[model samples]
Target: MAKKANWKELMTLHLRAYIPALVAFLFLLPSPVFAAALSLSPTNASVRVGSTVTETVFVLSTDQAMNAISGTISFPPELLQVVSVSKAGSVLSLWVQDPTFSNADGTISFSGIVPNPGYTGSHGLTISIQFRGKRAGTAAISFSPSSQVLANDGNGTDILNDTNSATITVTSSASAPSTPPAPSTAEQGLLARIISSTHPDQTQWYNRPHAIFDWTNAQGVSGVRLGYDKDADGEPSVPYSEPLSHKELDLEDGIWYFHVQEKGSGGWGPISSYRVQIDTVPPLPSTVTFPQGTTTPSGSSITALFTTTDELSGIDHYQVAVDGKVFTVTADAGSRPYQVSAGPGAHMLLVQTYDKAGNFSTANGRFFVTGEASSFFDFFSFGWLAVNYISIFLIAFAILVTLLFAAWYIRTHFMAYRYRLNRQLGLTHAHVHKEFDTLKEAITEELLALEQTKSKRSLTREEERLIVRFKKLLDHAEQTIEKEIEDIQR
Candidate 1:
């Protein structure tokens, strides 16, 4: 019985909970309670130059509308102008005017269905138009609901009067495309710039003509080259491309001009002309002067003066040679403008100058070096060298003779004086002469005895024996005396 009661209680709760839901579903089950309609706010508009104009269209229904709709509005090439168009719908349509119609009459239209309509909600459509007044006269344009053209509401109703008007005043045409500023003469000139020569120091001969042309507007030029001169001195114009080269023409020493022209699909561009001067005459060399009576040292430098000139071909170069050896010169070294240092002796210089047109001149001259002043020592030469040796020998001989005399004087005088002094001092009367005389006398006596004995004992045997013995004794004594004499002499 308790389980049956619980089941009955649960069924009652469920049934009560679903009763209100069922009633609400049945009440809101219809499509909508209203029909859609179209209307315009203000229904008309006005505007002036530099002012804005707007047109608005609205859609309504007796009850409510559910479907969404969208469409575009286009205008003629010349009529009212449309700046911007806006609409509120599920899908809004956008329109643009052709650039050719930028100044023409134009209009904008909008059509789209209402979106996300609730069970009891009413739906409406709105369109807003924006445009700029561009002229000084009256301009009119219109807009309307496109959906109502063929279709009618289910209850036989029509809501198509939602179209609106916009009035605008444009008081002037001065802002038209033809009112741009006109170009001046200079501005109308060629769109190119003048370019200076690339290298200022360069020059060329007319026979071997070479030139630099301003390529400021390379895009504007087609082909460029030198024109011919029939009247030799007249200005040359730009002609068709020619097979002749500057080498074939004589362009030396004169004023000249070149023509540059261009061509393109638009048309030919203006011809641009540039002027250049050609000079070929060489300058006169300077006068060369060497200082008189000058001589250079082995590695010293000397200077020479000279002259130079250039009327046509400006001075180009110069050189100085000493015995065919070229003296390397600094950039500014010259005779006319300046002078160059030459080696000792004579030098030949050739001054060569050239102009822009390749004209040149050559001049040659010589210069000398001055001899240096002399000192007394400078008078000496190899010739005097022999005298040096002679004087040396003479001095040596004199020294030798003096030494011999000095030795003899010292030996004789000093030795004799020392002997005398020794005698006076009683050291010893060294009778050297006496000693020598004694020695001589003794030798003479020995010789005499030997001779007498040899003569007296020639035939007797005992007497010969005695004489021999005596002679032996005498020889011994003579030997002793001779030794003593030799010691004293030394």
Candidate 2:
């Protein structure tokens, strides 16, 4: 009985080993009938804007049961925006390369929710160890196969392994710009002109509620667009009108340019351009009121006065000068007339007033400063007195002589100018000589024409005076020419 039992156990072991070997041969042998394969489902998955999408990566094999198989999906951050990741099952592990897959760990991982929520389309995560979703735009996520269970036949011979890959695309959700209707061109006979209250040029200051520019046209204007600019090249300020009109527009003081677009049934005509420059700077104080050549002392104080006003900024400060030196007034006195001090001897006293905006005006005048009494040597000697008297007379005489010479030179030069002008205008030299025959003739003809004519129906006095003065000027020229001819003959 023992011998029989041993033989039976041996026979059973042999049978077991032989049967597995036969199965292995059937699987591992070179047979055209059998093959191994692996693949993924939904290779190109897409998700809607602001939504989540889940896809299963299959490790499909011809064999019913395979072991030790793992897979991973990597997402490109540039392509898809990742929010979070989740993992499930002991067999699967999750890692994220914020680029392709979504997990806290910075690695290409699988077995978890990839790319946090709110990420959009085609997160094409490249094949890299550590992934940072740094790149953006249309991207893709590559699903790659990880090692799986190795399969063997009954004879312990390895049969095959499983592998697969896939890619997904993400789409964008931005909109496009509005399309404008096709533009048509036609002449609408529309005309625009600007009228102003102060300056017809419409670019200066005069009074409040100052009118700058106004336009009129024959045809009724339906709509208009108004555009303005400050600097020459910068983008224009935001356009002020959709349908512009004659409504009042308040403007500040500076260079300004304007353009208007008129709309009608015949389409919009070429834009009309107009400009206005408003200045609120108050005019400088007038009537500087200087004395007739007052002498300034060597170091004495001199004072001058002037009134000032500002339409916008109030007067801020004032300065007084003697030939532009020596401080005069240094205290603030509001809008009152201020005084400045200067040194003596025909000193030029100027009062410069400044507005809050740094606009300035100047008033010029003169002052005298006498030295302290009895500060000189020898008061009552005839010799000294005579010499002083002679010096005074000589100075006065020199000044008078200078004045006479200057007057003569000026008169002669002016006659020359008149002669030249008459000749250029095709008038005779004799006509030019009559204009400068005397001081009164010269003044009435050249300087006092407008004054003399202000009350007359026309410029009769001015015209008559100028004609006679011109004839005198021509006579002088003729005489000069005749003298030169006589010299040549001699």
Candidate 3:
């Protein structure tokens, strides 16, 4: 019987431990639900005050088939103003709510659904939001926590597991030149007499495949010669032709310059010129490359190498933003390897490449900064645990100091008032005076206890309530004493 009892006890102990382990294993198992993510393209941007910036939102499905998505993106209205919201390339076929934006509140919202056999993979483009920089500051474009991506399953399971946000920096307009330089003397003189041509006006844009050159000389000059080339020089591939009133020529799509000279026994005067641009297509988009994930030490900056290329017009400039702050803008293609200083925290860096013809492309990466808390006041340190403790300590210290000063001031002033009232009323031991003295003593003791407690921990809820009660009692005693003094004076 003793052996059987021992065996039963051991079985009970084993079962108790096994039950929790089984439950934990079950809980750790993956759920049937799928995970989805949403992110912003060109996740960062920088613009000058009064300029505009645009970014696209995208949705991706990791494992689930998504049928519907709804989300709201918020921004700081003081720094950025919503200009427009477009759904031109959105993947969702059915629109439950059209994308809309408000400048007043700096919010953009949209909701849409895909038809049966719900969309999968990258849900292509979602929507594009345009914002005009209103001030010189950094602003975060974030998705509201309530945003949702619903699965196609009949239950409408929320599959949203992650969301990425974007940042915008509005800088002073003086960062870049605002206007082009004035025309040179030769350019001015040549531009004066260049008559109209069949191609297009001087310094104008044209998409035509051919150009008809024409000239006029009311002086009835001996001969007129013409030279044309894509280069700025007067020397053309075909060389100068004999005097001709008009000539038809086929030309490729690009900027072309034409020079005309009049030969009136002067043997060809200075070459007069006009220019026409024949850009039939937009400049090719630029490619931007940067480090994927980087970690930097505390109090240090991370430098991201960036390379870009443009086939047609060549790269013009690059803009970089870090953690939603505008870091720098380089006007030349040679400017590579951008860098930005960051405090301890996770940050996103973005780079934008622009071609000479204004076409642009963007690339972004995520990085983290790690470091220990430098001091008690360095509450912004990256370590999560250290920051929490320091924050609590600072808050408690502020409250304790404020309460002590208030208590001391109130006690001193009220005591003086009571003494003056007693003298004025000629009452050394009135009921109001006695009550005031009792309350004053209570308040002084409570304040002393609070000061002592501050050395240990923050004020508890009960202690805060007691402080409020003490203040009320002091106020009542003051009113009673004032009423008695007024009666005695009358």
Candidate 4:
């Protein structure tokens, strides 16, 4: 209209304007694809020569569900040697091919798949790899550009949008370089952030006598020293030379203070400290106090009380045993007294006390239990208790009777023989009897002296010799008298 236009030219202008608008509209539309990412944890690390460093591989499924992944990681073989690869707790449930690594090639490869439901997370751990620092240099742990992460979206489309690599610096010293190189501004910012990984945690209680101190490896660190003491009054004076994470330390029971500091080109950093308690000693030996007398009636129960003291960790529990069999174990603090029922005869009771540190002490006592019996033979049914007492009494009575008869017979026969011997040899019985009386008196005096001395002390050597000599004289006199009797009888 406005100039009745040239129709073809108007149409051309309209087409150009609409084409640009359509293109913009198409660009604004949302795409159906999603992006995923793979990364190595501890993007940077500092390790000492002859020591190992571990790095974990993680995956992020952004907004997509990933079903399968395959990747290769490469490192400089001359500077770092592969130690091991761990796939524990991986998200992938199935393996297309297990993770494999070669030290010669300085490469690691893994291929795995998840179930149909797939997995989506920000920190899906894939694997952890350990490497030994072989030389003093910098090494890069990188993923091959050809690595693939497939989405579960039917088409198996590669959704990997990015990959992250790790950098490690290996030093010659056990901790860090004696002379650290000038650090960048970023490293200077990290100096105050150094911390220990295996610090004695507030909730953890160590039972072993030895411990290992571990710490995070930071950049620009030249050396690390550990100072520890038994108290908290002042700074620790002891020094640990190495910064190795597996450094073994021997510690005893009680409270301890540990301070860790790092040295760099800028001098030593601030000391990081912690207070911890170590308990390794066991409680004192338990004491079992039984009733005054050992005897108890059959089918009756008796109680024994236990007492124990612990200085460091305190008592945790007690265990009781009767006749080599466990009777009961109790954790109640008030349950110190224990009781047991006996059938008959004898029983042995043992009690053990334990500390929180798993150390224990034991004490034991023996007792007898009497049984009821109606008749003499019924006593025999009570086993060793009644039978042993009866046998002992019988043996003692038999010995007494035999001694009485022998005494009578010896007195009569000896007097008759001696009468004949005295008449024939012109000897007097009063002379022999006086000698015997003197010998008996000497023996009695020695025994009295022994009893009067201190209970702990023994008889003197001279006193012992005197008693022996007196006994020999008595024996000789008896032999002389007997010989004369025998000769007279002949």
lDDT of 1: 0.47
Q: Model 3: per-residue lDDT, tens digit, 292-404?
A: 44888887777666665443344557767776776546655335566668888888777776655455677777788998556855654447777788999999999999999
- lDDT of each residue in 1-490, candidate 1, tens digit only: 9999999999999999999999999988985433444444444444445444554555444443334333334433243455444432422232122111133435343444332441122224355545555555655544434545212334423333343444444444364642336544443343334343522232343423444544454443444334533121233355444222222234544434454444433444454444455543444445555453234453456545554544333344555555656653332455334444554466565554443344655656655555544556646754488789999999999999999999999899989986776555443224644564677577568657766877776546765565567667756765776576555444
The segments of candidate 2 whose C-alpha lies over 4 angstroms from its true place after superposition are 1-188, 202-212, 231-245, 281-368, 371-490
TM-score of each: 0.27, 0.24, 0.35, 0.36
Question: Over the stretch 1-490, how does candidate 4's per-residue lDDT look in tens digits?
Answer: 7555788788999999999999999999998768889999899987667656778999999699999999999999999987657666799779897787888999999999989889998999998887778999899999999899999989999999899999998888744444456666644543433233443563344467666665664566656666667423235344444443334567765545566666666766555555555666666676667754567787677767676656555567887777667754665642555667776787788778887667888888787888764766565566668778999999999999999999999999999987887675555555666777787788778766766773658878986776678678767877888687667656
Output the worst ten-in-a-row residue range by lDDT, candidate 4. 190-199
Q: How many residue pairs clash in each candidate?
A: 44, 57, 1, 0
Of candidates 3 and 2, the better by lDDT: 3
- Model 3 is weakest, by summed lDDT over 10 consecutive residues, at 281-290
Residue 290 CA displacement from its true place in model 2, Å: 16
Backbone clash pairs for candidate 4 read: none
Model 2 agreement with the true structure over 10-126: per-residue lDDT tens digits: 999999999999998888877543223334445555443433344344433343232222345555554454432322222222232122344543234432222222112222122
Root-mean-square deviation of every model: 39.1, 44.0, 32.6, 32.0
- Which lDDT value does model 2 have at 53? 42
Cα-based lDDT at residue 277, candidate 2: 48
